[model samples]
Target: NGFKLKEGRFKLDIRKKFFTLRVVRYWNRLPREVVAAPSLEAFKARLDEALGNLV
Candidate 1:
């Protein structure tokens, strides 16, 4: 299961402000290893580690 979401085409700039569009932008930025975690606990750990590296 991939974490990527197909972003929909938007005819207007305002469409980019939609919650789904905003979330997709953020989601697509995550590291593949974080997104590909095999379980919820693993995902949380990976996410925490990844975010910690940003600091």
Candidate 2:
């Protein structure tokens, strides 16, 4: 059977303008691994790319 997954919000690192995650241990269950982004807009763009790469 496949995994039952959930995605939480991206928590911001205010000093660096980058985003972090709520869940860290479930990376292996995910098809796309997250990359830290410099801004919200950049994060969205990269998120779209990650989703697009998913089969």
Candidate 3:
């Protein structure tokens, strides 16, 4: 699943160790799932896994 996250319609808290993504204007594009990591390493790992799947 590919979804583009934009601040114009959502809230994002991006930090070195933690990130938070929230849907503010969930009108047409309601989220089907939510995922977050407590650490940057974990986040990168998750991102890598997702990218690997795509290729």
Best candidate, lDDT-wise?
Answer: 1
The Cα local distance difference test for each model comes to: 0.88, 0.50, 0.45
Candidate 2 to truth, TM: 0.38
TM-scores, all models, native as reference: 0.69, 0.38, 0.39
Model 1 TM-score? 0.69
Backbone clashes in each candidate structure, one number apiece?
Answer: 0, 0, 0
Pairs in steric clash, model 2: none
Off by over 4 Å in 1: 11-15
Weakest lDDT window of 10 consecutive positions for candidate 1: 1-10
Arrange candidates by lDDT, descending. Answer: 1, 2, 3
Of the two candidates 1 and 2, the one with more favorable lDDT, higher being better, is 1
lDDT of 3 by residue, 1-55 (tens): 2354654432543532233334433322432232355577875776667656669
lDDT of 1 by residue, 1-55 (tens): 2668999997899998989888887688899999998899999999999889999
Clashes of 2: 0
Better of 1 and 3 by lDDT: 1
Cα error, residue 36 of model 3, in Å, equals 0.6
Per TM-score, the best of the predicted structures is: 1
Better of 1 and 2 by TM-score: 1
What would the per-residue lDDT of candidate 2 be over residues 1-55, giving only the tens digit for each residue?
0333444444555523323333433443344324445688875787677767785
